[model samples]
Target: KCAQPRRWKAFDGKITEMDTQNSLRGKELLEIYRSINTRGIPKDERTSVLLTLKWTVKEHECKLTQEIVALIDREIDLMSREVKECNLEGLRKRICTLFLQYIKIPEFNPQVAGLIKVPQDPLKLYKNVYFCHSCEKYLAPTEFPIPANSHTIGRCRSCYQLDNEARQREAYFKYRLILENLRKSEVDYQDDSKIVFLVQLPDMQYLIENIWNCQSALSACSDLYDLVMVRWDKQHEWSPWNTILLTKEEADAHLKLCNLQKTYEAPFIYRIEQKHIRAKNYFAQIPVMSSFLHRSSNQSNAN
Candidate 1:
């Protein structure tokens, strides 16, 4: 039979080669080691590899290294006893955690600098940082959602997620998709539309669910994906007040109408106008939106 390679060369050298070649971190290696059953390996071989790892980690003199070394010694002591494998699992996990910490430090593991999330510059670390009242932690601006009409910062996204899971459970994704489609369509029109850009996600949700009752004005289509909000009078630019909810097919036909008065009955037009008035009443509260509302009303009166 062929002779087996020494445990140090087989395990320790293999780990080092993996770290050098694939840039595998200690945490990743720990996960890989845990996935396999180490019980099949002899105690002497395991101890030999662990000793080699201890010597390699000892090269760095730090508080983290000291903790890792102490845990390794404790693990070796436990292995020498008649304790069950389950009893040693906890100690092994602790050693793995400390070693991961040791490997994360750029001073100990220079290869991890690129992988670390924290910016090295102190100025960059503090820039755009805000405090989340709910979580009581400092986080980046991206971690908090600032609504278009918001005057103050709210809790972080994680806190909002926890709150929503516990309470609201609102699905606003459909409204978001609608708003996105509206913005893209407006951009394609090249009419220099402004109101759609100012309209936020919550506003769209209210417009669909409350003002329009989540149905097409003409066909009463309830499918949100097939529905779109378009200008009631194609001559005027789209705004909350001047918009009508219709299926895509209906919108195409509605936009082609040269005269809304000639194309629709007085009662049908009156009903749509009532919806427009409600939209105006709701959106006019927004200071910026109020200006657009006044301008649209004036333009409609002039026409």
Candidate 2:
């Protein structure tokens, strides 16, 4: 009775590989295997780590039989004593592959259910396919380039690219750079950043092409690399409603700009307001960004 109590206490505490459990499930045994077998570990140190892991499994009560544990122990003991340059990486990986199946089972790990891409009912996958208007056929969801804020799904990515190539072909490389800079700036500001993730590539393209017209609002410069997107009002966090395109020179000047109404003429201010309204309407479709709009509106009301 005293021996059983000591054995249970040994397992109850941190069980090192050298510790022995009465039994172990396949998963626990695999964990023991992973916990040990440290490659590149010094030979003198390796024995201690291996011993701790073996003992840990031996003390735990699980599905593995005593014979299996004895066999594994014998192997480990031989390897430790022989000091042979035997590679165990492949064997360890094989064991991991076999044991991972237990962890991946839905019943065992319900938390991972959402991360599994495969549909529970594979035969019903066809139901998820959408009809692309441009392609004029049903295509899988992967083919579509739907933005997070898009109200309706449209053409697949391939169809959209082909259409752009034939018609309004414009390089979005500069737009991509501007978007990246915007994200970095937001991160530095350390405000809520989820709204940035909500904006997608297609949405950026639309804003550049239609809203800002892909040129400096003041100078109307078209040099892609020279142009940047900046906050309309310097005080506010950048958003679709609160952005303007400017040349690098203009952007620097605008940052130093103290008073918009004083520096810019009424007409200039009005046009900028119009652009803001358009952007506000466009970005409002994104569900997440709408929260920002409401918050901005309340802030404006407070002021």
True lDDT of residue 280, candidate 2: 85
Residues 152-257, candidate 1, lDDT per residue (tens digit)? 9899999999998864334466677778877887787788999999999889989998989999999989988788888887666678887898999998898899
TM-score of each: 0.45, 0.43
lDDT of each: 0.77, 0.67
The TM-score between candidate 2 and the true structure equals 0.43
For each of the candidates, the C-alpha root-mean-square deviation to the true structure, in angstroms, is: 16.8, 17.3
Error of 2 at 134 (Å): 27
Model 1 spans > 4 angstroms off: 1-170
Which stretches of model 2 miss by more than 4 angstroms?
1-170, 190-194
Q: What digit string (tens of lDDT, one per residue) describes model 2 on residues 1-303?
A: 101212333556864342223223334544554655446666656556555544654554445434334544554665666735565555445434433443344443343355566655666577887898876987778889889999988989989889888654446666678788778767776766556666777888898889878788998987767887777787787878777888888988988888988999999989998998998888887777888999988988999
At residue 111, candidate 2 shows an lDDT of 38
- The local lDDT score (0 to 100) that residue 117 gets in candidate 1 is 75
In model 2, the worst 10-residue window by lDDT is 1-10
Prediction-by-prediction clash tally? 0, 19
